[model samples]
Target chain A: MKTPALIVSGVLALLLAGCATRRVDESPVAAGQTTFATKEEVAAADEHDDWDTVAVVEVHDPIEPVNRGIFWFNHQLYTYVAKPFSKAYKSIFPKWVRHGIGNAYENIKYPIRVVNHTLQGRLDRTATETGRFLVNTTAGVGGVMKPADKIPALADVPKADTGQTFSKWGAPHGPYLVFPVLGPTTTRDLVGTAGDTALNPVAWVGLLFGGAAWTTAISAPSGAHGVPDQMDRYDMATKDALDPYISARSGYIQYREAASER
Target chain B: MKNIFFLLLGLCVGAMTSNASTEAAEANLRSTIDQVLVVTKKGKGGQSMANQLTPILVRHMCFESMTRRAVGPGWRQFTPEQKAEATKLFSKLIIRNYSKKFTPGELAEIEFLKPSSPGAGKVEIPTKTVYKGSRYNITYRLEDRGSWLITDILAEGISFVANYRAQFDVLVRKGGAVAVIASLKQSLERT
Candidate 1:
């Protein structure tokens, strides 16, 4: 095989390897057990189940310096390189044009979401995606595609919310991770990043640049712009000082709780 | 030689002109949003606030940037039509509810924190909100579309993305997706 072929083969082997071995840290909550309720609603339901109180203890909180290092790496890359292209895109593209591009990107991913959910054993996602696509395509401006899908019928309630999607396809909320600029993630989700990028048109487009710098240059500024908002959001969630990490952990857990309910 | 001179002159003049225009546009956009922000912070009416801020925000911010963080990665999933619809509905719903949730008086003391340009076209504005004797640090991302428009907002650490996820999750549970849409639409109408 040629050099490029060898590289491709290597990448394929790695992906295959990733699939074969399941890390305990990466095991997502069973999709069947995931819950689809908002924090408030879950609390309001008055059904104080044992799992509801399951804490998301910080298995590891690397010092602020480590967190800062990741943050800077992520932000610096976005600020200098990726942002300029996004600016260029904004300059050339009209609002409608950008909207169209964004839509195309989203619509292509439904199957992936479906597949991921199915793999995780999330039945709600199966139903949710069904309704999502049908209704989104119809009432939602010709399914130009929006995240939230709403149809007239609440066809399956208990099954939908109880736990379905997360169980089947959820990337195990592996050990706690604090990315440089990407912020917090886990080992499993980090790997899922590869899958996500594989399916993303932007990533494919960025790859044509022939190096990571091009991708970084195109993506960084856009990422930088989001930092404040992300930080602000983090602050808002944690200000109650009620263990936000845990809240997020539970949210993710309940997110998968649907499978158990099934 | 004469043509080359003219071309050179035109290039110089064009650069000067464009820069002037960009500067002016940025200033105008900045001032307009500042005024608009003040109006919103007032929180006087139920639905009027949404009506008032919509044009200003739309003009200052692009739909994609405003909702990216709020909506999460899933935002990329919206179709152009869905994007527009979601932008209209989600913006209205979120702003109205946020205005209703926090009083202008409570936020009176909060100033817009800076470092607006961290890099690229991204900007962050620190907004503070006080509730039940506690001060909260809220921030919003302003993506540059040649000017600033809020892309996403964070209340403390909780972003609209997390909140919306949680909200939709609950709504999905309560009545499935249909209920979530109905609830969102109802809220949009009310606001």
Candidate 2:
């Protein structure tokens, strides 16, 4: 019993160490501009600032060539395989049923959001989200319906994630990455995603059941379900672009920036 | 007693007028979204969608205000003409971006909810859009400027203006207004 407990503790410590290794240094900010409390505050400052000299805030992209190659490969995979699979999935499941499943998935993933919100010191969000989970789990019939959102006070509980938490903690987005089959992401978000996956209840249950196979089987579909919509948006965003790659990069960066802001 | 009664009546009328304006604003937004959806379903290409949506967007969206906020402090430096040019470019960029996001098959249904008053003269109208397998929450922030115009949009609590500003702030910091405008132009040309 003592030996098994020691091994388990050792494994947990190693896992945490792996996560710590993924965090890069904080990104540099411009002169006179403090790290903003909210994205809106940054915009508000922009509205009030006078014309001054400029300083570039560089996006660190050390392996652009490799990332671009992977981006192309992901695009092909999405267009050829993932999109078709998503289409079939859509056709098989009616809109309402699919929505229920999505809601259930979101409900199950509450721990990810709640933990991240708490880590970011958003107590109000943590409470409200916890309330939402409780209400949805029971009143919403195991999260198939989102009745809590109808409550005015609970309507706008923001979606918190590990990536956003890392940003709040001043972790730099180390480099742009186009993950194979995952499309556009950053080094920071890549790490955050891994952490979130590790924290997922479904993944843990699967690990308890049939180990890695069950975990992958359950998690893969959730990731795959959103691919078709993502691909469509990508196609639309880059339809008439001179360089689709640049457009995708700009869009992704802007999206992540806004998303990470409180 | 008569004077007091008239004052109360005036207050009542004011409340009614405010409620009426909010409803009108919500209706206008719904109609705009409906028109865009219809155009999207027609299988119109990007340019056509952009053309159709731009006028409606300009009419309803507070582009001047949004542009000012997006450009940040450097906005004071530009001439009125330059500001107008920047606003146009920004509007075009947004329209193009919006056009790209309009996939007909993905959106199964859209339902507009009652407007919430966030503050004086500002209302947030929430809409639930159901796609293939998920529901997205979108809130339009409308401010009354004679008529109600959208100042910002929040999708799942992420503001569109804020997102653009995050990217634009960096660009403006590195280069001046020219760089920012050039970047917008480049994005527009690409889209």
Candidate 3:
């Protein structure tokens, strides 16, 4: 188990190194100017009518080539492995059973959300989230049901994360990215994800408990719970896209923007 | 005095007409979903369901506008024939892709919330789709082109047009209108 973890860490380090070096300036189109002058002429002629040119000029996708490569890798993994596994998991379990598992996972990850909200100085949300966690854990039977939602005070509190906390701290969403097995993200969100993972109780258990207990905690519940929903979201975002990678990126950016508004 | 009374009455009638049209538009959208649901329930793959949905989609969706927006500035470069061809291909592509989403027994029901008047001629209807035990928000943005036709769709706030435009930009930059048309053709073939 340690061997597998070490190997994953090593591979990730290499990937990150690759990503670090490939960070080009904002315009990826500049690279194509030498090879595609005719296309550039067309772009120049109809510059005013081009919404894509105007809209994305500000969005710094410096390493789009690498991002696209990662996107393809992620797509294949989803298609051949993750999606099938998610479907199988869904088929085997009843909806309520799956929901219960998801609730449990969400409950476990409460600390991350609560901490981020606190960091962002959202004291009201932090308090409500804490109350919700406590209520759900006790009243909802270890959060198999969201009984806390019944409580008016807890119902309207928005979910927060390290990513939002980073945003609140004025960190820019540095370039669009596609991580292997993780799908779409940005540089800031990637850091936030890392922070969230470190803050996760399951990760702590894996560290403190060690060996079999750690493995069981990591491999069970949390790992399996959210796969179906993730797959469903991916399908919805990419199904109509002429290019799934482009569509997924667009959807992700828009989704993040909407999420940030909350 | 008679003219003033007539003007007030006309304003009241206009408001009622607008309200009635909004309701009618919402109803039309629901019926369209029902039709799609029927095809999905049939569980027949390929040309059959595609054939059933093509006309319904063509009538109810603003593919010409959607395709134009998606293609962006590159749209101007396309000739009349190219524009028409691209629109046809893009529409077919959407229909083909969308039809694949309807899995038998998956979509339980859809509940449309109050239609919001986003603009003078636009209505945005937010619907909650209950699939199995999960609920997802799918918003339909329709424009009044004599009838309410779907201009865009947003699943959990991810707009279809915006997403496609992001991709179409890169394609246009790398190639041009010809490349975009070619890419659409390839996508159609793949589907």
Candidate 4:
């Protein structure tokens, strides 16, 4: 009786909350959808544009030589290797298939997200992340398809990470460093990255279950997944600038800062 | 039971009709972008290309709206004259910065994908583009102001509006409209 009552209440709640949202409807108010610029809304809007705004965070690039050399190496790698591979991968897979793969990868990183969310004391976000994980894992066929994307409570929330957690804790970003393949990072974020890697289930499997071949197979696809996207965006952020290095550095810093704030 | 069936049938037709409109919106956006691309292809470079693109951009992009939102809540403190100045300078600043991103005489291969209506009068048209030897995903968000006008652009999942707003909001909170105007001027000069 209680279960039936709870199910009925859930149905009623969803029904009451639902509204007829149209696609490309010619209504005036749709232009000014009351999604206001609250502090929270910034993350939902996605990553930053290429605007050079006044609110600058100065990155301490003490190891400029190392960073620039790695940046140069990475640029060459991306141009020569990643670009061709990504083009081939994209041609082979449809957008939905690629998106599903991306969703699955993101889904598997649930521990890193939930842990960071918890560390930052974002209980609500942590709860939603857990809910998203459960729903995606069960209904989404091990999260190859993202059924949670349709859920109002789970939609559009940026995934949390250890770097963001540290930033929220008021840790200053130390020297900027760029790895050959992994690309840009600050000293603080490098540590965060390591911590995140430790928390990842895939990393655990590789370590514990001797899943070397599994990791190798997954690694290639993982590397290929976002190469086109990352390289293209990197070009957009840094290209045609007076100093490409400076532009890339600033963009990286700004992106990290924005993500941390959210 | 009869009423519910009719309601579902009505919704199905409504969706079909709206999907048609969404295609129209996509067509209109493609046309608008082509005009801007023509200007970009001219290889005018720097301020020259920006100046040419401004009129077309102005026709399609709501600078006043962008200016208002980018300024965030601090826009309320701005006077009429200041708001006008901010909008003008901001539009110029954005055009210059954005136009600079395009290389002269290079046209990107853009593939427009399925369009979705996130709400009444709002359409998000996603595109995959191969530009300058790299592929990128770009999404254009349009709102109906009698006609569809692009409100925001996302490049590789980065929001153009949110990026500007993040910086502007900080400045506005720190120093108000004057600071924002000054920052705009400095950025414009640098560009």
**Top TM-score: which candidate number?**
3
Give the per-residue lDDT digits (tens) of candidate 1, residues A35-97. Answer: 332344333433222112212122222343564466457556656654565566667766454
Give per-residue lDDT, candidate 2, residue A256: 68
Q: List the candidate 2 regions with Cα displacement exceeding 4 Å.
A: A1-58, A153-155, A240-242, B1-54, B58-96, B103-191
lDDT of 2 by residue, B59-103 (tens): 888887788766656666678887889898888877777766675
lDDT of 4 at A8: 38
Cand. 2 Cα-lDDT:
0.69
Return whichever of 2 and 4 wins on lDDT.
4
Selected candidate, larger TM-score, 3 vs 4 = 3
Writing each residue's lDDT as its tens digit, candidate 1 over B121-142 gives 5555665454433345666655
Tell me how each candidate scores on DockQ against the true complex. 0.03, 0.15, 0.30, 0.10
Q: iRMS for model 2?
A: 7.8
Model 3: per-residue Cα lDDT over A85-155, one tens digit each: 99899899998898988888888889898887877777888889999999999999998999886787886
Q: Looking at candidate 2, what TM-score does chain B attain? A: 0.85
What stretches of model 4 exceed 4 Å from their correct place? Answer: A1-53, A211-213, B1-53, B58-191
- TM-score (C-alpha) between model 2 and the true structure: 0.61
Model 2, A1-262: lDDT tens digits are: 3454355345443433111111011243343332212334334555334111111123456577898899888778877887788888889987777677778888999999998888778899999999999999999999989999789787668788887776766566656778787678776787789879877898897868968888778877666655556766677545544346655665576556656764
With candidate 2 superimposed using the best TM-score fit, by how many Å does residue B105's alpha carbon deviate from the native? 10
Backbone clashes per model, in order?
Answer: 65, 6, 0, 1
lDDT accuracy of residue A83 in candidate 1: 57
For each candidate, the alpha-carbon lDDT, in order, equals: 0.46, 0.69, 0.72, 0.71
What does the i-RMS of model 3 come to? 4.7
